[model samples]
Target: MKEMCPNCKSNFAAKDINNINKNSIFIEKQCPSCNKWFCLNKTLTIIKIIGIFLLLITSLLNIFNIKSEYSPVFSSIGLVGILMAIIVTFFGKHETVK
Candidate 1:
Protein backbone atom coordinates (compact mmCIF):
# COMPACT_ATOMS: atom_id res chain seq x y z
CA MET A 1 0.00 0.00 0.00
CA LYS A 2 1.07 3.57 -0.60
CA GLU A 3 0.25 6.41 1.78
CA MET A 4 0.41 10.06 0.89
CA CYS A 5 1.63 12.57 3.37
CA PRO A 6 -1.13 15.02 4.20
CA ASN A 7 1.28 17.91 4.50
CA CYS A 8 3.68 17.36 1.60
CA LYS A 9 1.41 15.15 -0.51
CA SER A 10 4.33 12.82 -1.18
CA ASN A 11 3.66 9.13 -1.44
CA PHE A 12 5.49 6.52 0.56
CA ALA A 13 5.42 2.76 0.75
CA ALA A 14 3.49 1.29 3.62
CA LYS A 15 4.96 -1.33 5.91
CA ASP A 16 3.68 -2.89 9.10
CA ILE A 17 7.01 -2.10 10.71
CA ASN A 18 6.15 1.59 10.57
CA ASN A 19 3.47 1.06 13.21
CA ILE A 20 4.17 2.81 16.49
CA ASN A 21 1.64 1.36 18.90
CA LYS A 22 3.51 0.16 21.98
CA ASN A 23 1.01 -2.64 22.51
CA SER A 24 1.01 -3.50 18.80
CA ILE A 25 -2.72 -2.80 18.34
CA PHE A 26 -2.53 -0.18 15.61
CA ILE A 27 -0.73 0.61 12.37
CA GLU A 28 1.02 3.95 12.67
CA LYS A 29 3.39 5.69 10.30
CA GLN A 30 5.06 9.02 9.88
CA CYS A 31 5.80 10.64 6.57
CA PRO A 32 9.47 10.86 5.73
CA SER A 33 9.02 14.12 3.89
CA CYS A 34 6.78 16.18 6.19
CA ASN A 35 7.10 14.15 9.40
CA LYS A 36 3.32 13.94 9.77
CA TRP A 37 1.58 10.94 11.28
CA PHE A 38 -1.10 8.55 10.09
CA CYS A 39 -2.62 5.50 11.63
CA LEU A 40 -5.04 2.69 10.80
CA ASN A 41 -6.78 0.35 13.15
CA LYS A 42 -5.86 -3.32 12.76
CA THR A 43 -9.43 -4.52 12.90
CA LEU A 44 -9.61 -5.81 9.32
CA THR A 45 -7.12 -8.64 9.64
CA ILE A 46 -8.37 -12.13 8.84
CA ILE A 47 -5.92 -13.39 11.40
CA LYS A 48 -8.03 -11.73 14.09
CA ILE A 49 -11.04 -13.62 12.87
CA ILE A 50 -9.12 -16.86 12.89
CA GLY A 51 -7.81 -16.10 16.32
CA ILE A 52 -11.33 -15.55 17.60
CA PHE A 53 -12.81 -18.74 16.25
CA LEU A 54 -10.28 -21.32 15.13
CA LEU A 55 -7.61 -20.63 17.67
CA LEU A 56 -9.28 -19.16 20.70
CA ILE A 57 -12.58 -20.99 20.46
CA THR A 58 -11.09 -24.20 19.07
CA SER A 59 -13.99 -24.65 16.72
CA LEU A 60 -14.27 -27.02 13.79
CA LEU A 61 -16.32 -24.39 11.98
CA ASN A 62 -13.17 -22.78 10.71
CA ILE A 63 -12.29 -25.82 8.61
CA PHE A 64 -15.84 -26.33 7.30
CA ASN A 65 -15.92 -29.58 9.20
CA ILE A 66 -18.64 -28.65 11.59
CA LYS A 67 -20.92 -31.56 12.44
CA SER A 68 -22.86 -30.05 15.28
CA GLU A 69 -26.46 -28.89 15.11
CA TYR A 70 -25.25 -25.31 15.20
CA SER A 71 -23.21 -25.81 12.06
CA PRO A 72 -25.34 -23.41 10.02
CA VAL A 73 -25.04 -20.66 12.59
CA PHE A 74 -21.31 -21.11 12.92
CA SER A 75 -20.91 -21.13 9.15
CA SER A 76 -22.84 -17.91 8.84
CA ILE A 77 -20.68 -16.25 11.43
CA GLY A 78 -17.56 -17.35 9.64
CA LEU A 79 -18.79 -15.98 6.34
CA VAL A 80 -19.62 -12.67 7.98
CA GLY A 81 -16.18 -12.48 9.47
CA ILE A 82 -14.54 -13.08 6.12
CA LEU A 83 -16.69 -10.44 4.43
CA MET A 84 -15.96 -7.91 7.15
CA ALA A 85 -12.23 -8.50 6.88
CA ILE A 86 -12.18 -8.00 3.14
CA ILE A 87 -14.26 -4.83 3.24
CA VAL A 88 -12.28 -3.30 6.10
CA THR A 89 -8.93 -4.07 4.52
CA PHE A 90 -9.77 -2.45 1.21
CA PHE A 91 -12.40 0.21 1.82
CA GLY A 92 -11.99 1.24 5.42
CA LYS A 93 -11.29 4.87 6.18
CA HIS A 94 -8.19 6.21 7.93
CA GLU A 95 -8.23 8.14 11.17
CA THR A 96 -5.71 10.49 12.81
CA VAL A 97 -5.53 11.65 16.38
CA LYS A 98 -3.23 13.49 18.74
Candidate 2:
Protein backbone atom coordinates (compact mmCIF):
# COMPACT_ATOMS: atom_id res chain seq x y z
CA MET A 1 0.00 0.00 0.00
CA LYS A 2 1.01 3.60 -0.59
CA GLU A 3 1.22 6.42 1.95
CA MET A 4 -1.17 9.37 1.84
CA CYS A 5 0.09 12.92 1.89
CA PRO A 6 -1.22 14.78 4.92
CA ASN A 7 -1.38 18.05 3.08
CA CYS A 8 -2.68 17.30 -0.40
CA LYS A 9 -4.43 14.11 0.58
CA SER A 10 -2.85 12.44 -2.40
CA ASN A 11 -1.51 8.92 -2.35
CA PHE A 12 2.18 8.28 -2.92
CA ALA A 13 4.44 5.28 -3.07
CA ALA A 14 7.24 4.95 -0.57
CA LYS A 15 9.83 5.69 -3.24
CA ASP A 16 8.15 8.97 -4.00
CA ILE A 17 8.94 10.52 -0.65
CA ASN A 18 12.28 12.30 -0.57
CA ASN A 19 14.29 12.48 2.64
CA ILE A 20 15.92 15.82 3.32
CA ASN A 21 19.06 13.84 4.10
CA LYS A 22 19.45 10.20 3.22
CA ASN A 23 21.27 9.35 6.44
CA SER A 24 19.31 11.45 8.88
CA ILE A 25 15.89 10.65 10.33
CA PHE A 26 15.73 14.05 11.96
CA ILE A 27 15.02 15.65 8.61
CA GLU A 28 11.62 16.19 7.08
CA LYS A 29 10.34 15.10 3.68
CA GLN A 30 8.54 17.01 0.98
CA CYS A 31 5.39 15.66 -0.56
CA PRO A 32 5.91 15.20 -4.25
CA SER A 33 2.45 16.42 -5.04
CA CYS A 34 1.77 19.05 -2.44
CA ASN A 35 5.32 20.30 -1.96
CA LYS A 36 4.56 20.48 1.75
CA TRP A 37 7.02 19.12 4.30
CA PHE A 38 6.24 16.20 6.55
CA CYS A 39 7.95 13.74 8.84
CA LEU A 40 7.42 10.42 10.52
CA ASN A 41 5.02 10.52 13.42
CA LYS A 42 6.46 10.79 16.92
CA THR A 43 5.50 7.25 17.93
CA LEU A 44 7.20 5.70 14.93
CA THR A 45 10.23 7.92 15.33
CA ILE A 46 10.58 6.78 18.94
CA ILE A 47 10.18 3.17 17.93
CA LYS A 48 12.84 3.52 15.26
CA ILE A 49 15.24 5.19 17.67
CA ILE A 50 14.69 2.55 20.32
CA GLY A 51 15.17 -0.19 17.78
CA ILE A 52 18.46 1.28 16.62
CA PHE A 53 19.63 1.68 20.21
CA LEU A 54 18.85 -1.93 20.99
CA LEU A 55 20.73 -3.09 17.94
CA LEU A 56 23.71 -0.96 18.89
CA ILE A 57 23.74 -2.38 22.41
CA THR A 58 23.71 -5.93 21.14
CA SER A 59 26.46 -5.22 18.65
CA LEU A 60 28.59 -3.75 21.42
CA LEU A 61 27.98 -6.77 23.62
CA ASN A 62 29.21 -9.04 20.87
CA ILE A 63 32.20 -6.86 20.06
CA PHE A 64 33.23 -6.88 23.73
CA ASN A 65 32.91 -10.67 23.94
CA ILE A 66 30.38 -10.49 26.71
CA LYS A 67 29.04 -14.00 26.99
CA SER A 68 26.19 -15.07 29.19
CA GLU A 69 23.24 -17.40 29.27
CA TYR A 70 21.10 -14.47 28.18
CA SER A 71 23.24 -13.80 25.16
CA PRO A 72 20.77 -15.53 22.86
CA VAL A 73 17.92 -13.44 24.27
CA PHE A 74 19.81 -10.24 23.67
CA SER A 75 20.65 -11.25 20.13
CA SER A 76 17.04 -12.06 19.40
CA ILE A 77 15.88 -8.75 20.77
CA GLY A 78 18.41 -6.99 18.61
CA LEU A 79 17.22 -8.81 15.53
CA VAL A 80 13.66 -7.86 16.33
CA GLY A 81 14.69 -4.25 16.79
CA ILE A 82 16.43 -4.17 13.45
CA LEU A 83 13.36 -5.57 11.80
CA MET A 84 11.13 -3.06 13.57
CA ALA A 85 13.25 -0.12 12.48
CA ILE A 86 13.20 -1.26 8.90
CA ILE A 87 9.45 -1.71 8.99
CA VAL A 88 8.90 1.70 10.48
CA THR A 89 10.85 3.29 7.68
CA PHE A 90 8.32 2.24 5.10
CA PHE A 91 5.11 1.89 7.06
CA GLY A 92 5.39 4.63 9.66
CA LYS A 93 2.81 7.38 9.66
CA HIS A 94 3.80 10.85 8.46
CA GLU A 95 3.08 14.16 10.12
CA THR A 96 3.96 17.80 9.52
CA VAL A 97 7.68 18.35 9.58
CA LYS A 98 8.95 18.58 13.12
- Scored by lDDT, the top model is 2
| Clashes by residue pair, model 2 | none
Off by over 4 Å in 2: 1-3, 13-25
Write one digit per residue (lDDT tens) for candidate 1, span 40-96. Answer: 544544344553453323246546565677766766766665666566665655454
Compose the digit string of candidate 2's lDDT tens values, residues 2-98. Answer: 8787778898886887746546655577888878887788788889999999999997887677876678878998999999999998888778764
CA lDDT scores, all candidates in order: 0.57, 0.82
lDDT of 2: 0.82
Clashes of each: 0, 0
Candidate 2, poorest ten consecutive residues by summed lDDT: 18-27
TM-score of each: 0.57, 0.75
